[model samples]
Target: MLVEPERTAYDLRFRLLGFPIRIHPLFWLGAALLGAFTLNMGFQYLLIWMAVVLVSLLVHELGHAVMFRWFGTNAAIVLYVFGGLAIPQAFVAGRWRRILISLAGPLAGFLLCAGVYVSNRQFHWASNPEGFLTGGREVGFFYLALLWVNLYWGILNLLPVFPLDGGQVSRELCGLVWGPRGTRIALQISLAVAVALVAYSLLCVLTANGPALAVVPWWLPRGTIFTAILFGLLAYTSYQLLQQLRWTDSSWDDRVPWER
Candidate 1:
């Protein structure tokens, strides 16, 4: 799930801020499927959702790429089915530096969210005359979609699950504290968290509660069926990685210095 995808004939290639970007065919499909609910309103709304997703994901990946460059490594961005990947052409050595690079993606999203909020307040674009949040306003829906993806998706990506930014940080921190046993410990942590999220997502879906829970309050984020499937796959990936680590006779971690 975390591997970089191979290039395809249908891939859309471009450059932004000196960073090469490739958008796989599956990326559009994934974005569309995720925003399929918006189609109920109209086709135009779905297009807006796709545009929001494209801009948001591009920003997120650029965040990582910028950090990679700051660390003296060039990186390429790829938008694939699962999400996006910022693949470093050259490796950066330090654990702390890598952690920062991992964090840059979500932090970038937050910054964009803040910028959008500020712009809305300044122009009063967020105001809805129909007294509904979106109120059939394209501008309102655009702001809503942008904020929702950045804020919620940013938080979700920060969970201590394998292959996520938080998971990378957790692994590094564990390695610092636990020495050779840290990678396994991090994977264990990832598995537990992912499993818990999967269960919560299932509960939400089964009860038809969506992203709210009786105990979680309406304000706090919960999970949906998509989250359940995503976390379930992550949990299984963690389990597989843990098993591999267990079988390795050497004291080294799964990734080599370059791979890291």
Candidate 2:
């Protein structure tokens, strides 16, 4: 599901800071699908949600691309249905380098979130933090969307699930410690984590408006059916990949789907 899609004539192409970027048509569709909930606020807010997704995801991919360049290779960015990928022209040799590249994406997001928070405070965009969140103002919702995508989505991307940045980091670290068997170990870990998340997401859905909500921690995020479906698919994908590796050499190629 995380694999890169085929380029088409309808694809939008551009370059930023010397890095080639491609936006598959499905990228916009995916963003719209995720932002559909914002429709209750009006079409304008839904558009704002898409804008936030674009900026946040572009920053995330740029983070990886910049890190790729620092290691002496150019990388192209592709924004697709799942998210984005920074495909380097040549393989980066070091495990540590790979780990940093994976980490750069989420770190970039965190920095953007910090900038948003600081700017909002400095300018007094919304005096009351609670009121800011609960207010119906478009600008407030825009700011909220920016913060949500960068902060919450960034955190989600860091989960140790296959194809996520954290999963890539986990694979590299496992390889460093376990040698040839690391790929298998990482996949196992990915499967377990993915399954656990799926379960938790379902629980969140069940308790979101139920009497059980009182027992749930206030800080825990409420999950939608979308999240449960997403993680369920990831869990299944991990299981399939794990089975593929099992019949092979107990080793898996540790490259992003775009590279493979």
Candidate 3:
């Protein structure tokens, strides 16, 4: 498999809350597109939903950043379309630390959902008509949607599939039993599982007969192409990891970088 390199418009270097951050231009472009598309809903309720989603994603990334820092690893978080990405410097060592970092993002999202649920239960936002009058029309629904999305996102990320945070956790855990070579093989299996998941999801979407098909905008094709590219990247990355493991096994010392 051939790996295609990522393209960028311009490199962005900045700092957030005293942490140095660098974002590729493509990431920013994706973020801008996401923001524009979301805000284009033109409804106050949707605007609130977009804000909550974006903020939740940021917090998810922040969870990774904080845990990475705690492990004495340099890391940066980038908010992009779909969700956020957390990149840790190569200096981050040890399997346990990697597992912690991988788990943090979803953990944060779960916590956010829990907090929202508690507030809703305590306040009875949905049951009271005065709640909307005081908080503006449909604000309660926005919060409900936000909480649901975050909770779902968090749980979905925990699936042991490739290119996802949970997949990394799976690799680390497998490393303990199978060592590096076995871990690499496990990742390839995970990729197969991911492909299956994508197929199943597409089937579900088609069977539901959602509005996605009827309202075929020009951007729909582009989105499909982008998704294909993402899957290709995941495939290539898994291949590369497998190759490295094979090389390690062939070597005299049999030392694998990914070994636990």
Candidate 4:
């Protein structure tokens, strides 16, 4: 008889090259939809770009995973639509280690981007139209686009806002000084920064005259539907963080030696 596998709170688990991995079913569903949409674009060369993106995301998450493992923390990698997540158990243990893990993702992405850039510059692919005019430029364009996407994604993830790598780094540094309470304050500040960014994104969408809102949809006007939903989600996440902070305060205060 085949033995049934153990289940965890997250979801189904699988082994990849002896490394345990668990993925929420929703993640695979989203990946399927994304692949379908990419296929519909009819850019056959985009498959190469997609492969590059997948590799970059994996490398990025690996940075976090390696650091977590080095610190003896249980960590799992989950790939999602935009990118991936590295959920490390006991992540709050050491401040500097936490900061290192947080920065590792973006560092890996940026390094990949640099390698692509150097290759492109050495090959002079973009400058040589003759190579494309004689044959086809699809591959060249795909690689260039991949480089840009990875570079932009790395920089974007570095933005100092909640749920971003930079924000996590900031939180970790603050935690060193303020203890668990400092993390709560940092989270609130990060959320505030996110709110400001969302507002600016909406403002840009509204000012632009278009059939639909460029960012979301025209039917969903700025501050009308999507914006409201965006803010609502942010608010909900902020509330959850606040609740977690409260629990941490009540429970950890007695056990942990805080700075203050």
Instruction: Give the whole-model CA lDDT for all candidates, comma-separated.
Output: 0.89, 0.87, 0.66, 0.65
Candidate 1: stretches off by over 4 Å: 128-136, 210-212, 250-260
- What lDDT tens digits, residue by residue, belong to model 1 across residues 1-260? 48889889999998999999999999999999999898779998999999999999999999999999999999999999858999999889999999999999999999999999887666667654445554348877898899999987688778889899999999999999998779999999999999999998888889888444667777776678899999999999999999888778356556767954
lDDT for 91 in candidate 4 is 45
The clash tally of candidate 2 reads 0
State each candidate's clash count.
Answer: 0, 0, 0, 3
| Cα-based TM-score, every candidate | 0.91, 0.90, 0.69, 0.68
Error of model 3, residue 47, in angstroms: 3.0
Q: Model 4 — which ten-residue stretch has the worst lDDT?
A: 1-10
The segments of candidate 2 whose C-alpha lies over 4 angstroms from its true place after superposition are 126-136, 209-215, 250-260
User: Which portions of model 4 show Cα errors greater than 4 Å?
Assistant: 1-46, 72-75, 88-92, 125-135, 209-232, 243-260
Arranged by lDDT, best first: 1, 2, 3, 4
Best by lDDT: 1
**What local lDDT does model 2 show for residue 56?**
96
Model 2 per-residue lDDT tens digits across residues 1-260: 36667999989999999999999999999999999898777999889899999999999999999999999999999999858988899999999999999999999999999999898877757446555543348878888789889998789889889889999999999999998789889989999998887887888787764776667787667778988998898889889988888777435556677955
Highest TM-score scorer: 1
Return the candidate ranking by TM-score, descending.
Answer: 1, 2, 3, 4
Candidate 1 lDDT at 223 equals 73
Model 3 C-alpha lDDT per residue in residues 42-156, reported as the tens digit of each score:
6665556666766677778888888988887767676544666777775678889889888999998889888877776677654453444334446655676668767866876
